[model samples]
Target: MLRQLGSGAQYLATDINQHAAETTQATLEAHGVHADVIVTDIMSGLDKRLAGMVDVAVVNPPYVPTHVEEVGCRGIAASWAVGLNGRQVIDRILPAVREMLSERGWLYMVALEDNDPSDICHLMSEMGNLREMFQIDAADYMMSICGDDSLKELSSPGKSGSIFYLSQDERFVIKTLRKTELKILLKLLPKYYNHVRAYDNTLITNFFWRPQDYSERRKKGSLCCDEKYVLH
Candidate 1:
């Protein structure tokens, strides 16, 4: 399905069972699609060559809960013999996919309700911090947000005197913080950062930037702030 959707993009498929790899290749051939199919255990031995280069990754890992001994078994059983909570294969694939992705990469994964998709998302979020792993410059992202001409103001129903602006891509929300709110956040910043770093399933909103005194540098169509701006 991904092959048909992204026909112009390169594809690489891997499986632990040689038969499964062969079947995948045959299916691609039948559909007149080209992809490199390899017999390997979840991208093993391909890291050095492909790390941090993949633009998109699709995963449908083995997710059936079964006895520990059933995992890695030969033939058809290897397809869905994930042990215990069905996270054995899924957990391994998460970090591997994170390593394989480019800075702007996206991942599409299949998960059962029993597999706990929320926890999986949280785990991937911790593993795929672009600023830490990819060394993306903070200033570059700030420039993109500040220079965006399509930012739209959202009406606030609350009586906190706060103004809200949504980014052009809708990936970020810029909120003008009051002096008291800024002080509280500044005081909590250290503890908050540490808490989020330690907890994989933390539900806190990710605050990207807290720029101070942006009134002088505001552009014509850019966001304006009297004191502080918080981007999340």
Candidate 2:
């Protein structure tokens, strides 16, 4: 994504581990991409400068339910360890993400059923009135596509350990699915396309895949799930 952002765009990345930060820099170098990588715990030191300047924010936070002590280990556990109800880090970052997002910014996050995805969206909406201006209109648009007032109901079980959720704007989605889920989606793609064509008002747009292996991609601690798919 940083590669596609162009040289003029400022791409910034953060991680708690210094090694992870350096590894990210090396990967970017190998890909001919450039970004300002920092070792900080979820925007800790840069929030003030980045406030309201981020046009796009993507977060694949730690969502696995575990003990509090397992939340912030320095080793590989940093990649997936989360606290009670799987919300330790997620709860902390929500406010920061809300404060940093530009007026038109969009956030794409990966969530689990235990995270209470609906409440997460609602919390974000309530934070500093993020959705106060667009609540009524956004609700109407959301209903046109989802046929309901709540976007949460659109969620369906995708795999053994994951689910999927689309935002009110239909711009991006929070998903975690498996290769089996991808296969089912591929089989239904034709009908889905036809339905979108028939309505001509939805946002089920774009489909593409990277050449890299999905498991190898996740080893980098990316949010891209097993056999990842992005429904724009």
Candidate 3:
């Protein structure tokens, strides 16, 4: 990314990670490159007006949830980053990207397996952009910054340890997830988090009954069962 920026491309950079944004600014400034760095939460809603006008917007958005307060990130994590996870991030950003992009302008985004590169391309295609605009494809997630999260801690199996059998030992690290990435992972998340686990590790017994996103419901319909956080 730094190399691409240094090649004399007029690029705009943004991050939900404030520290990362600061680092980006410092790095760009050191190379004598001036990039527009905006420290705002996209989840709070994006500035479609400004975003839709840029020629090319480069982004490597967050792949994981961050709970701490970061440097340049003034607001909460972007909708895609934390709230609805990866799918929402792309859904929220793509529209504005379409608006900001010049008629023939291109958006260079690092596609992830979690979010499905094909889905990204499909969405872009649906937006009236030239089908293929030089996309560098990637498979498997780049675990460049895989830090431990309270995902396990934040999940629950309804009726204490009696119902939910969590295989994730709090002592565990992030295991290599599937190619489907966060999309598949989301399917494993216990609906209501912070509940106790079942005594048996055979299956996660707890379930959180909560509201579903309008879109998810529209596609999968109401889940006969909430996303099962089983002991996989």
Q: Model 1, range 1-232, lDDT digits (tens) per residue? A: 7556766788899987888889999999998889999987777657546667789898989888889899768778878888877876786677567766877889999988878888788766754453463344444444445543746778752477677878776767888776568657644655665776687577877765433334444444354545456666
Ranking by TM-score: 1, 2, 3
Clashing pairs in 1: none
Runs of candidate 2 exceeding 4 Å displacement: 130-232
- The alpha-carbon deviation from the true structure for residue 110 of candidate 2, after best TM-score superposition, in angstroms, is 1.6
Stretches of model 3 off by over 4 angstroms after superposition: 1-10, 43-52, 64-85, 129-232
Better of 1 and 2 by TM-score: 1
Tell me the number of clashing residue pairs for each predicted model. 0, 0, 20
Candidate number achieving the greatest lDDT relative to the actual structure: 1
- Model 3 quality (TM-score): 0.41
Q: Write the per-residue lDDT of candidate 3 for residues 1-232, one digit (tens) a residue.
A: 5556565566567765688789889998997777777665442223323433466677666545334333224345442343323455555466446544665567787655766777666655543321121121111111211122222433332432212222233422222222244345344433212122223233543321111122332256532222322121
In candidate 3, what residue range of length 10 has the lowest lDDT sum? Answer: 136-145
